[model samples]
Target: MRFGIPLLFGCVVAGSVMAVSCKRGEHVWTAPDTVNIPHNTSGELIRYGRELIVHTAMYLGPEGKVATISNGMNCQNCHLEAGTKFMGNNFAATAANYPRYRERSGSIESLDKRINDCLIRSLNGSPLDRNSHEMQAMIAYIEWVGMTVNNGAKPPGSGIRELPYLLRAADTSKGRLVFDNKCRECHGTDGTGKYDSLTKEYVYPPLWGPHSYNNGAGIFRLSKFAGYVKANMPLNNARLTDEEAWDVAAFVNSQPRTEKLFEKDWPDLNTKPPDVATAPFADTFSAVQHKYGPFGVIVKSRKKH
Candidate 1:
């Protein structure tokens, strides 16, 4: 899949998220405090990353083939605008925070599995195995982010999370209040998103539940999740404050959902469509969307400013 211009990927510095566009044919290497990635390289790998972003946008556009949103905008529409602002845990540091974590699968999981899950949810794409070239390249980009956070040191949570400027920091109490007001309606009091047995998936599976994460998974943190929730969550219908977004996630993730131990990084594994383990609302899920569904992109719905 091809991509477009450098749109997202910002390094969190001094509690501030700074946008970093990966240009084509560039391999920059700069000091810890400043971003000085090379800008004029004739390298294939670097340019590939740049192109992928653009191409991905085309597929996600209004007229593109397999467009996800009904509003008729490209993936680039949402991604280019506030992708950095809504980086959430999409950035690598969040992945670095996990290696083996408890998953809803009743087992410990890894970062790669989490990535697959995100692609399914956010990117609306198929999952890439742990060993796939695309997955590795994306990881490389994240590792670069991890390196930056550690001030050029290769450390876990080494990316934006470790930047010199501390973000707002995860605050649980405040977050709880946010969840109750905005999120509680759909996700339930437990933070578990609703489920549909017939659909064999969650309608609003809790972020932290029996179908959620625990010890072996990347532990839930606020900064990243907040960014994501603020912009792309609740089906991209949120207008939450940064502090509130972070706070609500803190409250939700604080709960114990599922903490057995499972592995999700199956380099050679191919996943089939989910077979619902025990979805109480399975039939309900199918009927709801099929009956009263709103198709296409709906956010910032207007095409022109």
Candidate 2:
């Protein structure tokens, strides 16, 4: 499955591979270019997969052409540039690593299952049919995106960066101020987001309310949301300090959104991350603390045990 592209050397930081380019000097990881894809059937599938990733709502949203399923938000709404942006929940390492065990689901998951997980949780929708062209195209695109990377390598910016845990619970009131000042222009004052009637999708995704990611979605975890917001937010003017990011994430997650029941998740409680917003934790931390932390203690307790 090699793409025959030369590997760029990069340094490791916090256990992930950072990019090495002549200009940046090992700072940024770049996704492979789409133009390099072959002019073949598989390439066609890969291209279609990218389309699915970019315009998932057009094909799969409530008013979708392919199937009426997902909430109006597109996959790119969370994935950012169809999962090519660094530290923006991109899929740069996904294809290379998956069919791997996930602590959240507590099992070895195929890429297909992973996509469906997003459909169910993040998109607040039902799973796409596995055999459908849309599904196959998405798989091809995601695999092709990561084909150049080594197997089992998590490139430095593959996913959301883990910000240092705050010493206190994230303050929703303070977060509200941050959102009103920095986030409201794009996402709207009510947090319902800007709607595109022509495209029938969100131009800027809702931070909360019924259409946003459900409780079971990864970003519902304050850490994940904060990291994502700090890396990319306010439509390119992302200057939120770490504290501001953490607070705003708390504020957003506190708002009403969709809910999902993950009765089978986290079968191994010990492997669960501290920010999981649910009950029956491996430790005795209150659910509120688990949701909005002061997580340094929880993390330390886990390491000690």
Candidate 3:
């Protein structure tokens, strides 16, 4: 399948081909546009889902009508551009391969489970009732966006791509400079993010603070955060070197933010990522070492096992 640039009506004329690969193998497919939604119940549900994702805070924040389970951040904060843009934590493949096994929980999890995990961790709040209309609507939108994908397949560029680990732990001092130069303009020097007064939501969400993602959010993980920075930070243009990405991540994460929960996370110790914020891991490394760097050793050890 070939994808063209989407028009206002959701139709594409011609553009570059975006290749996607599933767990089975590489294939090409076009992402559907919200403009193409039919006038029907299913379309309404799908549209509702998109609204929930893009404006989650309005519906799920502390003052939300649907539920109060997020830190006033839209799902688009990390999922980026409504989960459509590639390498920006997009949801292009999420609906296709969920209800699959995840190392974090050490069980076969459903879409609702995955959504709740973000709610609890990234959103830094409680979980939505799995049967709730909000949850169902969000799922509907993800499924609609990914409906073209085959089940059990993980398309290439499905999620945030990883940047190579640094030779040593990231240097916060250097990272501070990088942040000042590249990120501080939008995220603010203090990392408190710029807000849209009219919407009462952040245009550039806080990177670290009470309102930011707690320590348990996936963004708290060094590699995940670094990769995301390398691929999508500064919006529109992403030109950070791998080292800059890592250093900036270290600098940002080293700052103060909300406390994290989840004592039972990564039930299978061996499956834990090297940069998990807390300790008591399958390895004999210290919590500080785990949270910081020289993660190549951890990666090598995991491979050996």
> Best candidate per TM-score, number?
2
Report the lDDT tens digits of candidate 1 across residue range 95-209. Answer: 3455554435445667677656544434433455678655565454444334433332222211222111123344567777777778788878876566544433344544664
The per-prediction tally of clashing pairs is 49, 0, 3
List candidate 3 stretches off by more than 4 Å. Answer: 1-30, 302-305
Best of the two (2, 3) by TM-score: 2
Q: Say which prediction, candidate 1 or candidate 2, comes out ahead on lDDT.
A: 2
TM-score of each: 0.38, 0.91, 0.90
lDDT score at residue 154, model 1, on the 0-100 scale? 27
Sequence-dependent TM-score of model 3: 0.90
Q: lDDT of all predictions, in order shown?
A: 0.41, 0.85, 0.81
Q: What tens digits encode model 3's per-residue C-alpha lDDT throughout 32-52?
A: 877787789998998998999
**List of clashing residue pairs for candidate 3:** 21-155, 21-156, 23-154
- Which 10 consecutive positions of candidate 3 have the poorest summed lDDT? 5-14
Model 2 worst lDDT window (10 residues): 18-27
